[model samples]
Target: MSDFQSPLEAFLYWEANSPNQVFLKQPVNGKMETYTFAEAGNESRKIAKALQAFNLPERSHIALLSKNCAHWMMADIAIMMAGYVSIPIYPTLNQDSIQQILEHSDSKAIIIGKLDNYATQKSGVKDIHKICVGMYNENDGELWEDIIKSTQPLETITLPSQDQLHTIIYTSGTTGTPKGVMHTVGNFIRSASIMKQVMGLPHGSRFFSYLPLAHVAERMGIATHGFVIGAEFSFPESLDSFASDLENCQPHIFFAVPRIWTKFQEKILEKMPKKKLSFLLTVPVLNILIKKKLKQKLGLKEAKFIVSGAAPLSINLIYWYKKIGIEILQGYGMTEDCIISHFNLPNDNKIGTVGKKLSTVETKLSADGEILIKNNCLMTGYYKSPEITASVFTEAGYLKTGDIGEYDHDGYLTITGRVKDQFKTDKGKYISPSPIELNLSKNNNIEQICIVGTGIPQPIALITLSELGKAKAKDLLIQSLSASVKEVNSQLQKHEKIEKVIIMKEEWNVDNGLTTPTLKVKRNSIEKIHQPLYKSWFKMEDKVIFE
Candidate 1:
């Protein structure tokens, strides 16, 4: 049970100690293909040798575009094993974003994993080393299958040091163009070590990898940290079969984003409507029965812990899952910090806060109230973007997190809103919009809520109701939002309150660039989209005017 020193060290160690242990499982053509510890390390080393023989360039960056698959993980490990930095992008990103990230990162090669249209995306990029997996037929560049045949001998496995650069993860780019966050081997080791201790993740603990592998959530939550702790990773075929995969894998640890958590919540509420679930309260026996039934449906019967991250989670969402016997804990972190900042300790649980900061992780509020973090996991700098990196960190070395938060007396941190989101009214009261918006948007009827009142008298909500909250059932959504508003507004000061509410129609998504990939509202972008509507609505005094 000695420390492995680095991710690459962990890889070699696991291969030697547990060569037959299944390290990675990929669902290929609806069948499972498990890669043993020896196989994962052996395949990755071969890819690294192939990359070296190709002789791309020195300190070159390799970009990987794919979902969470074994090949993607192996390819990523290849980049590191070959002494190259890995720049992984979301598979959901469009062509322009794909081009921007590659060009910006100055990537020399691109590895394509299982996707519907690999050739289509490969054709668009003008100048870059392109290779595709599962493409046995002849291609200009080496196929992943053929490349792994030339594995570098275990004795020849060369990788960067604990302090050397390991990976560069791009921000979701919700605000603008994505920024490459640089992380080193030391960062990965420290963050993973802290997580292993905190979560008590065991060696060879099985995990299901379904989140976007390119993002920090999957990078740390599954690939980097999960593997470092000797956890086995399994890939889902696709989102459509995520449930079936979960049931089959029966992982000890589960990590999911907020949207998936909400969907899981919706599944529970759908079968046992809130009213019916509430009706069980009269009988304690019925409550226990409901918990067992919900747990069985979510395929979390074997989960040691269900962790939610990558976005802010509403308290109501946690409470809903709590009723169904899911111990959903919220974690707060970012790409720059390797996806761990705070998490609820295993023995103690809190709903709103993301829980205690990791041991030896330094966190404090700035003069403007932004969460500042200083830890071993802080990035070296933005890849080739020193200016931006310098700007993100202060003279004290703590990252200027751009998020506004407060610490409860017990040391748990509750995020209040974004630093830039605190808008001033004409009357001089500063409004925190997200808190109010989250309060109202908690209802199943309200799918999204964006609060805007920039350069105006007071705050106003621009909400988009769920499909079920449409014209026919408008009263239901309105009832939920109105009651929520009244409850939240009651706690705020007069000038800090929302003056009125306006319902919106169009859905705002990160794909459309209206929201970040993590689902945080791009308020600046939303302002542009709703400018004309805001002007028209400003002239009127009515609330809830029919569109």
Candidate 2:
């Protein structure tokens, strides 16, 4: 059970108990700005007063548009304090997407802060009431600091009922249009309680909040959990200062996506060649010293829990980090579940799997092998879409996770692939690309891979080269990739074997509309773009073909 009834109650508890303690540490133009619990509460109350002064209806939906920053959390608190529902939008979303979510969620007002490009996105807000943060130089609406300085504090705090609407987190739209996932105050409380208990989080733990707070993983893991334990949050100034800021904060609990982990590995390998690093790790004293240096460099030396999520990370990459004394605990969850499905604890970690189910989570497999989940923290439903929401759950009321998986004898679950990601070749056999993609990604040269066949004779691997691969000569890259294809093919069935490896000239990214903000590849987009070329690519004489 949670110590407090709601997130606001937890925040109030911390404010009363640890008023003078630092709650948020944000880096601005190389300078660190901190807000104590008392100070944050004061600002939040002032913002709440400003919102109330607008005369919005009770329980009106208010949207939060910002990158992960101190003000984003404050704005969320302000929304809750004003007795309104919060709707968070991904900062990386295009203008149309921003408009879609705001209109779909029926948000009355929006609090914008710490955005990279507000000029292009400001049009999406249209005539909605916007409270912009001046700290980031946003001028499209009423200034945040100006209101805080001018408005009086809201004295009356409104506590939400257990089942009252809390927030609507819109999906990243990798599949289609973004759908708002409606969560209640009780969901946040239960999720926070589970995270605090499962991780043994301390009151004063330092949290580095770099991931998009709009994302459920970051929102629950950092913001909600921080309020529960009075944790100190540190935000990077920008991408350029992320390394320095993280190093300075030395956060106790750190979470990053698989792409970020890969980037860190690439950065380390840039300075130290893979072969040399492997050789040095064999020496006892040097290995310990090197691991310590690596931890310090990655700003994880003080981290108690380091986790990777959002997508499947290669087991080889996990082992690579293990060699350097960092054990990445890979977990599994979705937006609908509030990310409380499964996690690998530090002591009970199962390397290849996404760990066992959380204490309160019940998991089972469907007839088709899809993972089904039921937990106290699950979202009530997708906002404004009853039919769509009803379709995603089983008749037994479990959330159909859409991902196929298997449970080992020890109850550890390994995700094989998504049910929708399976495709059939012209030969009539359906193939799951995720496992093949995972195996092929073990080659350090391959950065991203999407196995496609659809209506072709056999599946072909479409890939973008990694930094290491890009730096190598063309012949060397071909030789290396060919060997990988041959090796991976040796383990697969004849019908499921990849016929060719096609190296694409362009990389799939958020900007290209080929990847989600969390960096998960849009398999549908991949098929749409390259399905016609699959047969031709498969007919190529060479084992590896550069596009």
Candidate 3:
């Protein structure tokens, strides 16, 4: 193995040493197109040469607008090979967000590929040179196919210095407009090295890249790490083929958000009822077979590491998986630090807490119990937002995580809530919604929940039903939810008791602007639309009000 200094160096090393090894697998029109290290390198270099032909300034910002696909990774390499900074925009982002990121980053060019809806988004890329991937049917601009045919492969590829800027990753913006987080070559190398060591990710591992490669976690954990370790990556063609693709790949490592884990659980439950599964698991021989079958069905039979992050996974969900011979390690980190904060390893697994910090990571709690983190892998700063960046860091240089957490005696961190997520009731009692929401999520019927008490005397739960919940009879759902609400309130203080459980008819999602790209509920957006009706709903006679 070569001692690589940067992501580009890692790619170069593999391209030189093991050119025949398969690198990328893309499912195109139900057929997998495989790219070897040599082939991928050739394509990336050719794209880099074509980009140089555009005559953009050195270190010019180039934006990538696409979902997880083979060309996205190649484009990243092309940007680096061309000595430019990459800016990745979330594919699900609206036109306004796309325009804001491109304009703010001052991108000279954009590589658009593999989008579900390109027509609506192409209007956002005005005045920028566009290179579209024709394979994915994104042909609004200069085609990628023509560039490779007409251009020569760049032969004078130069390695980037550690201090040179690598990419600006825009946050998915759970609250407000997304901010560009600046990361350098050194940051990527350092973070990837630490994570590769900590997670024991081996050379030539198999990775399934379904998560948005634009996000830091997926960027570092899968795409970047795969490059560093000479791993093979397979991408799902679309939502319809996601399960089949994943099942076929059976990746060694799997990382998903809490929402994805919950969806998997729902899918499993839909196939096998809870009562039948419980009885089957109680039998000795059948239990092993059932667990193995379930693992294979979920495409995790060969997974060496299964991780959940981006949001707190419900502890009950973890326990439920544990009973089925799978242990989900809930890790914690944000985009600011390149997601090098903490994780629960297999040997030292903790159920309710996000496990201990990485070897080079430093963590401390602030006066208000907000988690503060300091690490060499942290981002340089927010792009074009110096004042906002300065405000996020303490005088001692720790990033204020905004998440409220408490470390157990042995150092496992349990996230209680968010600092800004707290709301004051009319009676002057402050309520942190996260912890309450986590508890409420234990109810299988509830898919999403937010606790709000802005103008009311008591906090009320705004909830959307899970598939299991939606499939149940109205009377059954009300009875089950009412019991859950009663059970949760019984364990809380008088002021903290939930006033009522209001089941919202509309599900919060990215299209509706109620959730982030990662599926985290946008509390601010939810409050803006529903707060006015809170009082009226609170005064209703029903304990479980269906809205």
TM-score per candidate, in order? 0.93, 0.98, 0.99
Ranking by lDDT: 3, 2, 1
Clashes found in each candidate (C-alpha, N, C closer than 3 A): 1, 0, 0
lDDT of 2 by residue, 281-328 (tens): 999999999999999988999998999999889999999999999999
Give the higher-lDDT candidate: 2 or 3.
3
Leading candidate by TM-score: 3
Candidate 1, overall lDDT? 0.77
Task: Give the better candidate number (1 or 2) by TM-score.
Answer: 2
**Clashes in predicted model 1:** 1
Q: How does residue 125 of candidate 1 score in lDDT?
A: 56
Q: What is residue 376's positional error in candidate 2, in angstroms?
A: 0.7
- Predict model 3's lDDT versus the native: 0.91
Give each prediction's root-mean-square deviation over alpha carbons: 2.5, 1.2, 0.9
Question: Could you give me the TM-score of model 2 versus the true structure?
Answer: 0.98
The sequence of per-residue lDDT tens digits that candidate 3 reaches over residues 1-547 is: 8668999999999899889999999999989899999999999999999888899888999999999999999999999999999999899888888999999999999999899998888788899898999999878778999998988899998899999889999998778888999999999998888778886777788999988888888999888889999999999988888888898899999999988888998989888989999999999999999999988988999998999998888889999999999889989988899889989999999899999988899999999999999999788899999999999999999999999999998999999999999999999988898888999899989999999999899999999999889999999999999899899998899899998999999999998899988889999999999999999999999999999
Write the residue-wise lDDT of candidate 1 on 404-485 in tens digits. Answer: 9999899999888887777776667788887777776676666677777766676778876655466336665556667777
